[model samples]
Target: MNELRFRDVSVRFGGRRRGVTAVDRVDLTVPAGAVVGLVGESGSGKSTLARAAVGLAPLAGGAVLLDGRPLPRTPGRHGVQMVFQDPYSSLDPRMTVGASIAEAAPRGGNTTAEVARLLDLVELAPERAAQYPAQLSGGQRQRVALARALAARPDVIIADEITSALDVSIQGTVLNLVRDLQRRLSLSMLFISHNLAVVRYVSDLLAVMYLGRIVECGPVDDVLGDPQHPYTRQLLASAPRPGGIPTALTGAEATLDSAEPGDPHHPPPGCRFHPRCPVGPLVLPGRDDCRDTEPDGAQRRHQAACHYAAHASEQHNTRSTP
Candidate 1:
């Protein structure tokens, strides 16, 4: 069985002293035939992690393992593929969709037959293969990207916000296609997005990133229904609902400033999230522990990096006991 494991992986850009740490000691696994959703804010390093999996980003510390073996920095070292957010930009406007897809197939393979099959797999007409990217809709172009990724026959698929550029209705179609393909092919996938609802829809396991660190991770329902991290809870609360009424997890209105404040280049001391965690100071008041010590990180299947994970639940329970 194929599995992609990121063991204590960390990614930093620029010099050690001045560089920004884009992905902090994050450990994640996308087991064979499972779809893992990674959700977080725009700068949470979700894309950076995905890029690392595909050899785009270099690891500063730790390793990215494929089937328990560390992946080499060279391209195609592991059978991992990626689909980007902008399908239009991902494909070459100069080449026909068929040519683009065929380029990814193994050398000496029947490019024509394979292209047809790939197009069909992505729910596109075979004739559409002859069309240029400029001739396709946003949704169709995205499908072409999926077809190209499929042509590689990779063991793991890293989809980086693939549906973020499409309309809502089109987004659903693309997501459904991904879900169907993942199940049918028994493919391991890392679906990255900032939208909670979208992630919740298609993931078996959910891992939440915050400021380059994985703040929470577990089974999809467990993390979504009972998010252990305050950041996770805040994201859930701020997501807009179908009825136009936004739910508040802590009665605080959603705003641009809801995210924890800290510099990516120079993170805060102790808990990177303590500066903004609403309950950390209250739970561990005047102790300096919350501000001085980072939690022991992930434990077991469900992990949360919070000093208040134990007491926060009790406090929430008490508040809702009425």
Candidate 2:
């Protein structure tokens, strides 16, 4: 069973004139005890989406359901918990680490000893529970936050860049701990990160987002290994590879099959990827609309909003324009 689900959720800030639509129509389902990854760049809406999952961010539009129930407009028992990027910001500076964990003890951790036990689960000595957030390193502080969330025994955990702030060595430890914790506790996780490597390490299913919408999504292996979406391909090409040759993604050429937005409510006419696409120079470089409008980053099974993707396999194989 899926523990958490987002149905065409949309969140926008400010007005049409100035505000940015942070999260566009997004639909995601996270299986109970499954580790799903939500990966994207800084402005790609990963954090906003994660915040929505945890009930910390208001939904400008659409529905968010937890275990088949509508989530309350406010944060409450949907058994959802979040581990933020900066452990220090999430943890209190004034309270002892133990005290902080005890306060949010998810399962009603009633005793100090139980709190210590939570620390043990996260691989902490439980003695460190006596220290404050300032006393612990970034990784250690995150463990404390994890322990606190574990105290609740949450059914769903939204880990938002919890390891991004840590050193590489510490990050590996924390990542392993998260994997171990999920296996032992059967906790469902929506792991959010911009790092493709990290996402690959943690997620079973992967979602690639651009702007505020999901551009492509599929099983981790399929999306990373044989990405069908042009954007996905671009990302893979840009990331480090075995030979370390950076396969550059030039703009994409526009094809006729692309979505055409008749009204502004619709995204825009032709392929959403026509702009900033590498091959656009050859296909429809003369067409200027691709430069004027915003593409709705919507998806249906590794969906590529590029019309050229209609011919991506044939066209992309060529790499450069003829």
Candidate 3:
């Protein structure tokens, strides 16, 4: 089985004065044949982590391991491939769809046969291969991109916001294709998106990132249904329901300001999220722990990084004590 492990990984850019720490000692694993979803706001380092897996982002500390070996600097060199967000830009507008998919085919492989098979795998008609990117719909283009990724015959495919650009209806079709493909091929995937609903749909395991850290990680349903961290609760509360209505989150007001991502160069000290953590007081009780402590990303069952995760547990136990 091929497993992707991020061991104490960190990514820093620029100098001490101007440098930002995009990813901070995050340890995560995508077991073979599983889909792991990473959900976080823009600049939350989710994309940076994805980039690190594909060797696009340099790591300041730690490493990325594929089945106990280091990931190659160039993707698809060792069965690792990435399907980027914008198919329009990722695919060559100048080249025909068949040509693009053929280019990604394994070395020494029969390109024509591979393109036909991949296009069929992604549910595109064989004739569609003759179409150019400009002639295809957004969903069709994405499927073609997926076909291209499959042509590489990768063990792990990093899908970075592949559905974010499509309409909601089209998003579901693409998501279904991804889920079906993963199961059919037994492929491991690291799916990155900010859409909670979409992530919940496609992932078996979910990791929620805040700022540059994974604040929560667990089974998809468990974490989203019974969120342990304050941020998780906040996200659940803020995420829109089907009717286009924001679910009314009790306790803290929903206030995830749509600001540019935080400066990695100067993240707030203590808990990076303490400044906006509404339920911190409820969980931390009478301490300033949240503002002065850094919680390591050690998963305890469905782990959460807040200092008050234990406190909340204790409180729950206390309430249940008979």
lDDT of 2 by residue, 1-322 (tens): 5479999899877777767677878888888878988876567788988888777788888888887888887775548888999999999899999889888864543568988788889999978978999999999999999998887767899999998888988899999999999989888999998778888998888888766777677788877866666667666666776676665433332332232322223343344444445555335456454455444434555554444455564565565446
1 against 2, candidate with superior lDDT: 1
**Backbone Cα, N, C clashes tallied per candidate:** 0, 14, 4
* Candidate 2 regions with alpha-carbon error over 4 angstroms: 76-78, 106-109, 242-245, 248-272, 280-305, 314-322
Best by lDDT: 1
Candidate 2: worst-modelled 10 consecutive residues by lDDT: 255-264
The estimated TM-scores of all candidates read 0.94, 0.84, 0.91
Give the Cα error of residue 247 in candidate 1, in Å: 1.6
Q: Give the Cα lDDT of each candidate.
A: 0.86, 0.75, 0.83
Indicate the TM-score of model 3: 0.91
Which candidate number maximizes TM-score? 1
| Model 3 lDDT tens row, 4-24 | 999999988888877888999
The sequence of per-residue lDDT tens digits that candidate 1 reaches over residues 115-203 is: 99999999999999889999999999999999999888999999999999998888999999999999999999999988888998999
Off by over 4 Å in 3: 75-78, 249-262, 281-285, 310-322
Model 1 deviation from the true structure expressed as Cα RMSD, one decimal place: 2.1
Worst 10 residues of 1 by lDDT: 248-257
